[model samples]
Target: MYYPTIRGCIQALKNLEIWLDKAEQHAAAKGFDVGVLLTSRLAPEPSSIS
Candidate 1:
């Protein structure tokens, strides 16, 4: 059980790296700052969560 969980976590980290690389490339191609994309949130603001 622990082995599978650890493996999944490793895979997730790998996937995140790949995603960040793609996002960086995309932002560069569109003439935007990579930092803007990196700092973006997928969910609504904290005040709206309530």
Candidate 2:
């Protein structure tokens, strides 16, 4: 049980790293700052969430 949970967490971290790298490459291709993507949120504002 614990093994599977730990494995899942590690896998998720690895996937996040891959996604961040891709986002950086995409930002460079579009000539925008990678920080823009890094700092972006799923919602326009945190207060908007209920």
Candidate 3:
């Protein structure tokens, strides 16, 4: 379980890095700072009731 979770986290991190790279390229073309929208992951979620 831990191993799979760790691997998933690592993959997510790699994807974030790739996203940032693309964002940087886009920003450079328009001369602006690059960043990611982490709100989706940071926001609280509803608890399961069942």
Candidate 4:
């Protein structure tokens, strides 16, 4: 199986961060903890190629 390159992984993480930031802001306005609902990949996980 072909895995994502470092650049691709970086891009995916960046996009995830943006979405997570938005969700966090929304949750904060409602008095909720974002961390409880979100998890960040400090390192990438294995992905199966289809």
lDDT of each: 0.96, 0.93, 0.74, 0.78
- Badly placed stretches (over 4 Å) of model 2 are 46-50
What ranking of all candidate models by TM-score puts the best one first? 2, 1, 3, 4
Per-residue lDDT tens digits of candidate 2, residues 1-50? 99999999999999999999999999999999999987988777767765
The lDDT leader among the candidates is: 1
lDDT of 3 by residue, 1-50 (tens): 99999999999999999997887788789885554433235645556333
Superposition-based RMSD of candidate 2 using all C-alpha atoms, in angstroms: 2.7
TM-score of each: 0.75, 0.76, 0.61, 0.53
Report RMSD (Å) for each prediction in the order shown.
Answer: 2.4, 2.7, 7.3, 10.3
Error of 2 at 1 (Å): 1.6
Better of 1 and 2 by TM-score: 2
Query: Candidate 4: where is the Cα deviation over 4 Å?
Result: 1-4, 39-50
- lDDT of predicted model 1: 0.96
Task: Please identify model 3 stretches exceeding 4 Å from their true place.
Answer: 35-50
- Number of clashing residue pairs, candidate 1: 0
The worst-scoring run of ten residues by lDDT in candidate 3 lies at 34-43
TM-score of 2: 0.76
Residue pairs clashing, model 1: none
